[model samples]
Target: MTTHTPTTPEQLLEKLTALGIEATTINHPAVYTVEESKAHRGDLPGAHTKNLFLRNKKGKMWLLVCLEDRKIDIKLLGKALEAGKLSFGSAARLMEFLGIEPGSVSPFSAINDREGQVKVVLDTQMMTQSPINAHPLTNTMTTAITPTDLVRFLESIDHAPEELDMNNLAELATKAE
Candidate 1:
C-alpha cells in the first residue's frame, strides 16, 4: 500500500486558491483551545470554529466542527448521531487518520484522509455564517474562507459533511450549559 503524503499548510492554501476560494490566513501563537485563540485572532471576521475529532467504540470516526463558544455534550451528540457512546479519538488515531494533531484539528485536515475514514460533521449555524475561521491543518495559523467555499473544499476532497442542525443541538448545549 502506498502511503499518502501529508498535505502541508502551504499546500492547503494552494488547494484553496486552485479551487477559486478566496481565503485569508494569519500567523499566530499556537492556540490549544477556543479561549486562547480569541486573543490571537485579532478581530478576524466571521464564525470561529472549534473542531472535535471523535471516535465510537466500534471505530467509527467523526470530525465535528461548530462555533467556538458553543457548548457540547458528547453523550447527547453521540445519541443524536447514533454513534454509540462517542469519545475523543487519541493523538495516534488522529495522526493516522487526519494527519493532524489534537490542537490543529479542522475540517481542512480531511483533505489528508485518502480513504475517507472520517465522517465530517458541521454545525448548521456555522454553515450560515461567512468567512469561517479554522486552522489549515496546523495550529499556528488561522485560515478564513466563506461557508460556501469551505463546503466546496470539503467536497473537492470527497469529505462532504453531515451538517448538524444546531437548533436541535441547542438542547444538548442546554444540558451542558
Candidate 2:
C-alpha cells in the first residue's frame, strides 16, 4: 500500500494555534488560481471558497469570500455596498495588506493584518457549510475549519465580516440576461 503523507500550511498552523483552533491542511505545490488548485484536491470533503481581494474607489480594502461556483458582478456590488466603483486591488496592495499573491488569495491571509486595514465579507450561504475549505496563506495547501471555529478565528483577528446574501449573484445574472 502506498502511504500518502499529509501536508499542512505552515503559516496557517501558526495562526490557528494562536486562535486555539484545530485544523488540518492538505499539502500540494503552489497553485496560482482556483483552477490550478483542483489538481491537489485528494479526497477532502467540504465546501471550497473563492476569495477575492478588492478595494473601493475610496481605497478601502475588502476580502470577499464565497462559494467556488458563485459569480459576482463588480458593478452591482459597487451599487449595493454604496462604495462607488470597486476594483480588484493591485498586486502591491494585496501583498502589502494580505501578504498573498493573485491566485493564492484566501481569508486566512487576513491573519497577517497587523494593522487591521481590511474588511472581510463572507457570503451568507457559506456560513451554512460545516467544514469550509480555503487556502492557508498560500495556494500550496488547503485548510478545513468548522464554521464556529472560523468565526472565532476571525474574531480573534478583530476581522468581523459582513455576511451578504448569495442572491446578489442571481440578481446580477438576471440583469445580465
Candidate 3:
C-alpha cells in the first residue's frame, strides 16, 4: 500500500494561485472550535464556516460544510443525503481521507483527497455569503475566498461538491421522529 503525503497550507495556497483563484489569509493563534475562533475572527467579512467529516454505516464518507452557527441534525442529514445512520469520522479516518486533523477540517482540505474518496456537501445558505472563511489545511490561519472561487478551486482538484440548503435540516430531523 502506498502512503500519501498530506498537503500543506503553502501548497494549498500555491494551487489556488495556479488556478487563478484569489484568497486572503490571516494568521492567528490556533483555534480548535467555532467558539474559540470567534475571538480571532472579529469583523472578518463573510460567513465563518464549520466543516464536518462524517461516515455512514456503509463507510461512505462525506464532508459537510455549513455556516458556523447553523444547527445540524445529523440523523436528518443522514436521511436527507441518503447516507444512513451517520457518525463523525474518526481522527485516523480524517487524516487518511482529508489529510487534516479534527480542528483543521475545511472544504479546502479537498485538495488532499487525490482519490476523491470523500464527497463534499456544501450548504446553499452558506454559499450565498459574499466571502467564506475556512482553514487552509490548519487552524492557525483562516482563508477567505469568494464562493465562486471556492467552487473553482474544488473543481480544479476534481472534487465538484453537492450543494444543499441546510436551513431545514433541524425541521427534517423533527419530522423524522
Candidate 4:
C-alpha cells in the first residue's frame, strides 16, 4: 500500500477548492498557546477560533470550537452537553483519531476523522460569522474561510457538529493566563 502524507493546511485548501469552497490561509510560527494566536490576528481578518479536543469518561472523542477567551468548565460542560464527563484527549488518540498533535487541535483536522468517529461541537455564537479563522491541521498555520464553507466541509467529512451553549469558556481563558 502506498502511504500518503497526512492532511496539511494546504492540502485542506485544495480539498476545499474541489468542493467549491473558496478559502485562504496564513502561515505563522508554530503557536502552542491561544495568546500567541492573537499576535497573528491583527494581520488576518475574520473570526478567530479556539479548538479543544476532548474525550468523555468512556473515551468517546469530541472536537469543541469557540471564540478565543471563552471559559469552559469540564464538569458543567459534561452536564450541559450531556457528554458524560469530558477531558482532553491523549496525544496518542489525537494522532490516531484526528491525525493531529497536542497544542495543534483544530476543526480542520476533522478531515482526518475518516471514520466519522469523533463528534464536532461548536459554540452557537461562532455560526454567526461569515468567515472564520482556525488552524488548518496544525497550530503553526491559520486558515480563513466562510462559515458556509466550513459547514460544507464538515458535512462532506461527516462531522457536522452539534451546537451547544453549554460551556462558558471565557472564564476558562482568564484563569489559564
What's the ranking of the predictions by TM-score, best on top? 3, 1, 4, 2
Q: Sorted by lDDT, highest first, which candidate order results? A: 3, 1, 4, 2
Q: Return whichever of 1 and 2 wins on TM-score.
A: 1
**lDDT at 168 for candidate 4?**
53
Model 1, global lDDT: 0.90
Which residue segments of model 1 deviate by more than 4 Å? Answer: 170-177
- Tens digits of per-residue lDDT for model 4, 27-145: 77888888888876566766788888888878778898887777777776665656667898889888888888887788889888887889998877887875788888888777788
Q: Which digits, one per residue and each the tens of the lDDT, describe model 1 over residues 1-177?
A: 247778999999999999999999999999999989998888899999999999999999999999998888887888778786899999989888998888999989999899988999999999999889999999999999998998899999999888987668646544544
Show the colliding residue pairs in model 1: none
Task: Please provide TM-scores, in order, for all candidate models, with all chains considered together.
Answer: 0.93, 0.85, 0.94, 0.87
Model 4 clash pairs are 69-170, 70-169, 70-170, 71-168, 71-169, 71-170, 71-171, 71-172, 72-169
Q: What are the per-residue Cα lDDT tens digits for candidate 2 across 12-105?
A: 6886887789887877888776677666786788888998888887888888899888888887776665566789999878777876778778
State residue 93's C-alpha deviation in candidate 1, in Å: 0.5
Residue-level error in angstroms, candidate 2, position 88 = 0.4
lDDT of 3 at 31: 97
lDDT of 3 by residue, 28-113 (tens): 99999999999888888998999999998888999999999988888889978877799999999999888898899999999888
Q: What stretches of model 4 exceed 4 Å from their correct place?
A: 1-5, 166-177
Q: What C-alpha lDDT, on a 0 to 100 scale, does residue 174 get in candidate 2?
A: 50
Residue pairs with backbone atoms closer than 3 Å in model 3 (clashes): none
lDDT score, residue 65, model 1?
A: 95
Top-lDDT structure, candidate number: 3
